[model samples]
Target: MNETRREYIKRINIVLDFIENNLDTKLSLEYLSKKAHYSAYHFHRVFLTLVNESLNEYVNRKRIERIAAILLVKPNSSLKNLAYKYGFNSDNSFSRAFKKYYGISPTKFKSEGKELLSKIGIEPFSSEKYICSIDNIKQWTKMNAQITIKELPELKLASISNIGNFEKAGSMFQKLMEWGHQKRVLDTSNFKAITIYRDNPNITQTSKVRFSACVTISENINTDGEINQHNLKKGIYSIGHFEIKAEEISKAWKSMSIWVIENGYEFRDGDYFEMYHNDHKTHPEQKFIIDICIPLQKTENIKLGEINNLDLSKYKDNLDYHQLISYMKELRLFFQKEYDTIFKLGKIYQGAPNFSYFSLTTDELKKQKLKFVIILNHKELYFSICLSGQNKSIRKKYWKIFKGSDWNKYHLAESIDNSLSIIDQTILKNPDFNNKRNLTERIEKESLKFINDIKNILE
Candidate 1:
């Protein structure tokens, strides 16, 4: 992924977000470059190429625009305090910069902010012309949405970027679904169809606004053509669930922005997206059921660097992915040579880099359309064996039977859509590989236990 165009875009987006949220804090190239996990030299080149502006110039412009925006809403705010807050040494310097950018003194702009901003064709975030009235807007929002402040988890998405036209989302989603099915990475059980606004609609020109038609995927995927893979970072968000017609979606957005302002919640620089729950054409009223997500400032309780403390890699084995695959092949051969006539064996399968497995089935189990799999998870450093089926339909059928009964001998997979396993048991956790023979013996013994137990149930 390194040096790719999409990788640069993803890194730059992170830096852009950090600048937006931390305008009042010291934003040095050294710190920001580290945040993007790039050298300062490469970071500068990429940022310039992608943003079409030097990093310092962009940061300065953002700071000035933020001050001007605040003055639009609060004319009497102390210029000195605001100047110092946004990284100016003195009021004189702030006033000079403001005049240079807006072509008027800050004091004059404060009095005629709306008119001045309109002349430049940049509407204030909360323009009265955009909405009827605060009360009416509130009523409309209350009728159309159920709003909540939630902390959302990180999402893995396979997305198609669509610039300017959001109407082509239907076709984009269709393409994504087809691609997802082809790759066998669709979540199926808890999948989400999301549209992420890459640029602020309020700030960017309508014809230039960017959106990504995205869907939840089960695993990491390589970027292909126009489709890219990205992780929507976990963060706090203001979520508004709405069921509205196509034409009224713009109104829903306006109302949601007003709700954030009225509730005294500051907007953060994360993505603003809509998660669609149902197809509008299916509804009698043709209303789309969706959840609009607006990123918000993390509360004081969410301490910085909290997530960094919890690293799962410590629990994983030091064995390389290739080394683990080699071991799995050895185990597969061990089973084939030992079981011989008892259970037919399959070759080792390495679907993704993180995991690999092989199947074993007896004549009786094959009649029931079932197979057993011994899997090794390189990422988690665990070995497990599972009872699976020839296909999804067989897996689902038996899954339902076990789910209804009290067969608690093993852990059952929650869904069969993306999973081949119906029932599973971890044979070894944090395996001790220093004694290779001992490890092999333990696996063989536990594997026999699972195979025999499952055979008794269905044989």
Candidate 2:
């Protein structure tokens, strides 16, 4: 029987995944059709209608893609053995199928197929030349990333699919948020944006890759639109946490893959996805804190390590009010030192021991008494570029420009908007004064960036 659009997509994906993983085994029409819960006669027609490829053609293409990737990485392996290993009946048949798909003999592909293989999206970086890039691997490891393997629970997601470029997923996410709001289930505690990657970039052409922008939902909710319900299978996953700019995402993925390979983990044939922790728009550097999860083969011999032991001990929650005041003193001193070094202005405005205020006076706006404020509290610690003083009218005049300008670019304070503004970046969640110098550098860099952004906006 033919399935609904959602069912067809879901069942076909299961079959596709099975096909990719079991290319070395027999995958007869009856078997695949039964697995997809369809009668063989209707299954063939349904598969062709949805995937636009005959069952045999689609299976052969994926097998060829997989073989191409393996050959690129293992150029020294026997061609005949490789062909047989991937379920080819004979050398002649394999050669014909390979040639038909790639327009080149396997021998020619191994000898001079780098460009051709890349054109078909089968560029395996495990090739001898790339494997020797020890420096790149070292740099990646130095990111101090702590990767762990864990059993992930199956997630039922409300997802919107996007074909081709993954950049289009942003719009999908926005639409999902709008949908969640309309349904009155948009609480932040449970709601989270996720991206499901459906194709291996190493084997599939990027422009033909499929993905879905999804949000975790408690159960299958009613949806009559393009947004459909999907389930992420529960399995062992190697998750890598990353804090990086958007452009560094591809590098992060590569690094994670390398880490997995180095740590002796085999990748499972299933969906890979990313779950975001913070909004990039709110980050001062526009960096995303994302957890990249890769499904792994579940074997008895594999011993998994700690799953979520990210060394964030430098930020602790037991800070009392006295400790807060002490940490604020350190922050104030550091800010004063930085300002004095740059502008020769020493300890300009030290507000009660809990906060510090520094003045910024350019020739054009000296009367404005623009101050950069740093606040340390038991609950949270943050700093921002704001306006303070008795200059009420001047503050109001500039506040108008600040509000009307690209204020979103600045991290505006959420609670206090009148005299204080733009607390876009938090210096520390829980301060530890023992590592004061390092924390000082981080806050100083962020404070300067905030000042510069505000200056441009005001100008």
Candidate 3:
């Protein structure tokens, strides 16, 4: 891509984002040209060349499709309100435009939109209909996937934005991998190829829906022309790990969506993506191994985003988190088997993809309503332990005591109102995992020291 083309794509991307987000408002060539810093006529030509559609044509299609989506969800929803809300002048005008796209009037579309959508080769995801047939979805998911709720860590990514033509993604990923190898910033220990959906295909016109092909980066690399750099938000998600044929990808996503709704989880507005594992081309039956991740609202009592206690940057590394998780499981078993009499160890909690931990409490500490947590933060590639109470009130009481005291032996919480730990200590950083036994011995020494020191303080 040349400099002029790059600038054109970048500017057009901004305008597209704005137009998609604000379709209910007046969008004129002059107003949109201002957004692109181009003259109205020049912007018109640029949009036509890049998008292969006139600005008005693109806008009108989007509005009509959005109305189509609404009708699918609410067959009785007022077409006049929806059509006018999306910038149509009147009922007759909206009908003409809607018919141009769907080949049927808006009123007819409200009744037969699903069939119309299927004819256009677009799969519809209707929330209203999905709710009615959730039991089958649940059964399908149970037979095909192992689903769980997880908190994914913030990830640094280099991505290429693509519109509609998803078949081109394979080539896009190839280009990205080549670029990553050239930069020497690929996390080779743990490789991740992600496809992020920027627009809901069910609501937006399939040809206009945007998706991005992304790869994980070990450093904060600068964006190159069409490739951009950004971070995936850290949040709660409903993750479904599946190994399915290429054709079943859409079914996997829809099933996951229905499962999230059926489980009482409110969807959070964020990235809905697929983290691909194996290339379908290499599979015997051409199957893609993937994890479908859907962002979700935090459960009550677990205050997400309220506490920024984890100094995430302090432990950033190129370590493969999945590999680190395997190590964590091994280490947990070592403690359980070797010190069974000395420690009552809890199972490793993997609710989050970026970190995992197990609880450790002695008989004496159990009476005190306290335990210690050994956490492996794969984002930082380090291990740390914290003192936590059995409940929120207990943790709060201990946190206040530490906050008031002059004990600087470890990192204390600034506030406990939303934090999980009272005080924490970093026991190890960037472990040399090649020699597993040596690494385990080192961790054992440091962890025991932190535990004894904290115990002495309390006693």
Judged by lDDT, which candidate is best?
A: 3
In order of lDDT, best first, we have: 3, 1, 2
Rank all candidate structures by their TM-score, best first, as comma-separated numbers. 3, 2, 1
TM-score of each: 0.49, 0.56, 0.58
Model 2 agreement with the true structure over 1-459: per-residue lDDT tens digits: 243776777677667657756888999999999998999999999889877789999888878877776665467879888888888999999999999988899889887666775666565553333434756664554443446788888877887765476777778798888887777654456767899876666666777566779897765676434666777888988887776778767666767777777766777767789989888887534778788888899887565665332333333565443455566666666655656544323232321223444444444444455554555432234544453333445456555655666657545444333444433445455444677788777777766776677666667
Q: Give lDDT for model 3.
A: 0.79
- Model 1: pairs clashing at backbone N, Cα or C within 3 Å: none
Clashes within 3 Å, all models in order: 0, 4, 2
The whole-model C-alpha lDDT of candidate 1 against the native structure comes to 0.78
Give the Å shift of residue 225 in candidate 1. 7.2
Each candidate's lDDT (Cα)?
0.78, 0.66, 0.79
- Is 1 or 2 the stronger prediction by lDDT? 1
> Which tens-of-lDDT digit does each residue in 1-459 have in candidate 1?
344876777677667757867889998889999988999999999888877778887777778877875675467888889889999888888889888877888889888766776667665555566466788887777656667677888999998775577779899899999999999998888799999986665544466566789999989987675677868889988777776789778788888888877877777767899999888887535778888888888766433322211123544455555567788887888878888989899767653445679999888888988999999876678899999987778999999999999879899898888786899999999887677778889999999999899888874
User: Which 10-residue window in model 2 sums to the lowest lDDT?
Assistant: 344-353
TM-score winner between 1 and 3, please give it. 3
